[model samples]
Target: MPTTRDYEYLLECANVIGVDYNEAENRVKVFVSQKMPPETLADEDDVKKRVQETDADVTVDVVDAGYDDERAGYEPLSTLEVIPEALEGRGERHRPVPAGVSEINAISTAGTGGPYPARVTADATDEASGAVWSDAVGADDLVRLSNNHVYARSNEADLGEPILQPSPQDGGESDDEVGALVGYVPIDDGVRVDVAARSVDRDRESDRYLELEDEWPTGVRRDGYEELREETVTKTGRTTGVTSATVEATSASVNVDFGEGGTITLRDQLITGYMSEPGDSGSAVFLEDGELVGLLFAGSTEQTICNRIANVEADLGVEILTEEPDDGNGDGGGDREPPVYTTTFERALEVDLEGASLDLESVTFGGRPQPGATVPLRIAVVASEPGSYWVDVDGDRERFEIGGESSDDLGHTVTASAAVPEDAAGTLSVSIAGGRLE
Candidate 1:
């Protein structure tokens, strides 16, 4: 088995800016700049020799792109058509600060705000690069969350330095101060995250993102990168407003160029197609159901990079505040419908027992498949002898024993259930295993 540590060693190659592990394919995708052609990148033989060392079944693929921390400093873009406040282009300032607007250090930089005034947990931090995120309450005060490069200026800003709304680039003045830098997870070699936070008055911010006022980041998704692969993700930002993209890779390693702050390698990054522009840093990434997934920080024309929200919470030592589900009472929690999460390919199968006149009929599954959700299965056995038999579906099995003697006209029905795997794909194999006449 190839460990993640082994995959990180592949970054040692020249011009290899990033790498991602595709668990389903058992492939390691190497992201290199256009300056280096894919052909020149380490081929399968070379990668195996350099990284695999062991007989781990790993393949290598080369992709071309460059990446940078996405912080558009104060430069203005044309106004988009007026829409819902949540979906509006957020370069301009708002009275009550909401996420997805220009917010950054009081210096000359700019990035978007994430979910404001919400209590969020763990992640890293930096300054002067991207958006501020949720309103996680620190020990004594409400904390405004964002990328370290946006709030702490990539570890350069002083604690207690003023943070501004609308960013200086968007004409925010000293009077627009909403918070001050309190802490950040430092960016370093092989850093897992680039997040930071500042203290703000609860009254100065809204606990919601713009253009997504109705949906709160309900919870932080703690599942690994594999869960997010191919899943649809969305972000609201100072630069792009609201945009959606499919997650291309979950366990991606990125070389984030932070301009004057130089470049650094971020591992375990969440990769998405182009859904962000400069000044979109610190934007919170969400699943279709509004679960917080990652914190947007870096990107290129080809891809966006994010710190997984779970990592953010671990590094920042704060819980990301999410809206509580309404219990149909007068108390708190947002009112949102239960989500119908989908799974991979659906399959149906039938089987026959060898050396035993048992006909397994209509081995069918009930309910739409959701990843890891249990679906009930019913298998009817005809002309069955009284025996102990097992039914298998994609390696999971349930046993059924017939108590009566063999009969020609009788039919026995048995119930079994299987939980779909996360990487469910292709056909499902259903069969009788360990069948024996009693």
Candidate 2:
């Protein structure tokens, strides 16, 4: 098998624009600029020959737009005349703006919105552009999320600038402004993420995506690379509306040409089929279960490009709040099932007692936990006594008091809460060793 470093060298090739590696199949799909001649890098046979130099067992594949066509970056501009009318949701002003609608910075032309609603971490600074991705929360504010090129005008627009819905091209005016540019992760060479945010006006904030009536992102799946390989994913965008495609590559590096902004290489991108178009930039990409996966940015006629949602949050210092925040009044109180189930561990105390006994029943998580966030760890126990009990969850030792139970009738249940480590991931193993205190 060719090491990742070995295949990375191909990206340096002038004609080679993108690369996808399928570890299971031992296949390498090379996407070369369509402007290149067939004799140079377009020929599959020639590309395969080049692969033989590395490892004969590895398969080499070349992706192109065919003989007469050329592949170019799908700039974030509406080409409604070329797109089928049925697929284009007539760009128009929408109250409490939803995802999959047309939006852009006042200074720029157009692009789709972010997949979900979002806010920036700091105060607004300037105007904005590009399609909104989705509504998100940052620094306790509701902000609109999208590509930097879309919301931040490719890092050109000043902060706090107006962001209009339906886009200026769609007849949007100053009165239609929804938010202002708060901040963005500046685009740079080998940019790992292309994301920006704007403070959403209270009246324009919404959690709905166009076609997905009631569905919304429940969580962010950061390291779903293995699960998404060859899996199906979908996105709702300005030009394409709702579309589905197979995830061709979970890890991709591509050179995107931004016209005057120049060509910059983007690393660690998700590649899908031709499910997007020019105006689809900033659309949120999701798994079938509605987990936010990537943020759509650039693509070609043959494939789509997106920055992983995980990278979007890390680079922007924000979290895509999947659920609504508490109302603070604390009036809404009830017990509900968790949104998702995660791996957990259950263990019995294994110590027998005459009258008083203890058993560790189960440990559960309310939802997907991330670093720096407190996870509500629930521990179920059945005991016969009231005293301080120590439980070891993974490595974090938790001590809690168990009271009001002294029985062998199996009628007593005690629940204790604990905290997981900052680096928690995968399964959570829990064990306990405690007895009734005097």
lDDT (0 to 1) per candidate: 0.64, 0.64
Residue range 270-358, candidate 2, lDDT tens digits: 88877887778788888888888988987766678889898887677566766434442212223322321111121212222223466
Q: Number of clashing pairs, model 2?
A: 35
Candidate 1 lDDT tens digits, 294-376: 98987666777888988887766656667422442223355432211111112333343554655543343445556667776
**Runs in model 1 with CA error above 4 Å?**
35-56, 66-89, 118-140, 324-438
Cα TM-score per model = 0.63, 0.65
| Cα RMSD of predicted structure 1 | 23.7
**Which residue window of length 10 is worst by lDDT in model 1?**
72-81
